[model samples]
Target: MPIEVLPVRPSFVARVIGADLTALSPAATAAIGTAIDTYSVLIVPDQHLDDDHLLTLGKTFGDVEPPRNHRVVQRLKHAELADISNLDANNRLRAADDHRRLDSLGNRLWHSDASFREVPGALSMLFAHVVPPAGGETEFADLRAAYDALDAPMQARIEGLAVEHSIFHSRGQLGHTDYTDAERAALPPVLHPLVRVHPVSKRKTLYMGSHASHIVGWPMPDGRLLLRDLMEHATQREFVYRHAWRVGDLVIWDNRCTMHRGRSYDDATHPRDLRRVTTKDLSMLQPA
Candidate 1:
């Protein structure tokens, strides 16, 4: 079947149809890649994918990032898939006071995946195997449009600035302080340009998010204010797409040019099991 790409938003998201994600042909792969480059988010609905199937689809884009050596013990057994759920290892709901649940609360804040890593993430694929009756929607902001919408003066002011991002800073905002000294040492903050140009599409995008602590070479107070301002501006209603998920839905997003957050859901009473596989940026694999 011929692949079809239908826009979900005027700016940057689309729904792709008529391709088997598990057994994509070269032509289908090219079409999907082009769709992704044109629309940063692609939603493929009513699809069933196991871990192996998810991994196969993820590798079509780039190197699938290994599951993080998380400081917090992981409940999921699969090393390739990140568990984005409220259940424990035995699939029981965690207590309201569970530290893992607290850690996941940070997901409510807008963030780009792996922004704090030296080699930032390129793309992320999330599959919804179970979804709640209400809420649990994921919201994505189009940073490309956000960058273009800026006034001339504002654009010039931020064009060359960089920001320092850290996992500690983002998680700290939600009162998650379980990281040990060694974990902190291993995952120190990294710097990335506030305005990034997509290597393929050649479009520029704003990269600030919850993980972005402060601007480089600026006073802490001023830097934080600027970061907050940019985040607010980028996530305005006009530049956003809110996706209401359903079971058997697969959503892929470019982390390099977007910021996303999970909406609140009734985790204690409802099950919302999702699996995620991410690919590393190609540039990260290149020799410096």
Candidate 2:
């Protein structure tokens, strides 16, 4: 049974209608894989998924990425479920000045999940348990579309370029340097091509985000400037989608061709709870 999908945009983004993620038919599952390659982002509403269910669904995509030590308390049971929320270990809203809250503020920066790693993330499945009354929407930019919009000469210039990405650099941008020495050592910088061809779709997509520190082998200042310029161009309104989250909604996005960021909400006054699981990109094991 093919899943019914409504396109949110001509180039990317769609809403999967009336499909129970927990009990997918083989045909439906294949349709979803096809949808991901075509749409890059899918919003599935009215899902009832627990941590166990989320973990199971994530495995259908690929190897689930393990949780990284951000020096924050582990609120969830599964090591694969990332605690994407404003609550503490006790399930209460965190203090406005809590270190965990401060560190999470980096999610507001446009970034592809796990781009700083040696093996970058492929798909990010985020499930909304509770959403704030206002704000807190997630925005995604279509890197394939952004890349296509580039002029021919600009495309040729960056065709063979690679970028050095670092988790420290992105967190440093927000003055949130509360990392433990062990955490710092675990998350050293890595290199990835500036433009990578999608394994399934074969479209050239820009592999950049807040984690992208600078272009490899270029002078620091020049590399930073180029990265900044590319970021500005890639995130133009024409290539972006904003998702206003609702409770029970699960959004899945392809990190291979998209960058996303969370919008601002009143963290002190309202509670916004979401959990995420990402899959590792196997294409990363091969040459990019």
Candidate 3:
């Protein structure tokens, strides 16, 4: 069957059908790439994708990086391919917002993948291994729209603004979000233009991550006030989409121009498992 791309909302997501990426024709593979460029989020339903298939789909874009800690593999799955959920050492389930010790990033505000690092991610693939009866919806905001929505004066004011993004500032000494000291050491603070240029589409996008602590060289209070104001304003309802999950639902999003956050899940009461993979194709975007 030919591929079908159905938009969930005119502005944001698309439900992709008619092609199996795990074993796609050359034309179909190219089609998925084009779909990614046009729609930031592509949802595939009832895809019983195994790790191999998942890896195949990710490689269609760029190098795959998996997270490093898991009972599933020895020495870890790298930092890019991670099973994103709250499962403890014993492999028991956890609550969404609850943090035990210094482990798991399930307790964050909002972020784009790896914006704190020198080379941020280009795409994110999340597969719903399991879903709870309620909760665990993921939310995404369209940054291009956010940038376009700002008033002219505000737009001009932030055109060249830069921010210091650091994971250290986010986790601190506790270091529980699964990165070891050595791993964390490998990642250092980086600067990102508040407004970035999309490489393929040649559009401007808002570039803010949870790891962004403050604007460079700005006073703390002033930075915090401005950052908070912009974040809240950009993430307003009109510019966002919330996705409810179902078993076998796979979500692929353009990390370059989207901001995503996890909604609360009934962690303590039920088990939810989601596998995530990240892609870093810097050629798709340029530093502003």
User: Which candidate has the top score in TM-score?
Assistant: 2
Off by over 4 Å in 1: 69-77, 284-288
By TM-score rank, best first, the candidates go 2, 1, 3
> Which ranges of candidate 3 are over 4 A from the true structure?
66-80, 88-90, 94-102, 105-108, 172-184, 284-288
Predicted structure 2, TM vs. truth = 0.98
Off by over 4 Å in 2: none
TM-score of each: 0.96, 0.98, 0.87
Error of 1 at 108 (Å): 0.9
Q: Would you list the C-alpha lDDT of every candidate in the order shown?
A: 0.88, 0.92, 0.76
**Residue pair clashes in candidate 2:** none
Residues forming the 10-long window of minimal summed lDDT in candidate 1: 68-77
Clashes of each: 0, 0, 10
lDDT of 1 by residue, 128-223 (tens): 988899999999999999999999999999988989999889999988888889889988999888998887898888987899999999999999
Q: What does candidate 2's lDDT look like per residue over 1-288, in tens digits?
A: 457988999869999987888887878888888898999999999999999889989998899988564666778879899999999999999998898888889899999999989988999999999999999999999999999999999999899998999888898999988888888899899999999999999999999999999998899999999889999999999999999999999999999999999999999999999999999998999864
Ranking of all candidate structures by their lDDT, best first: 2, 1, 3
Residue 136, model 1: lDDT of 95
What does the lDDT come to for candidate 3?
0.76
Q: Could you tell which candidate, 2 or 3, scores higher by TM-score?
A: 2
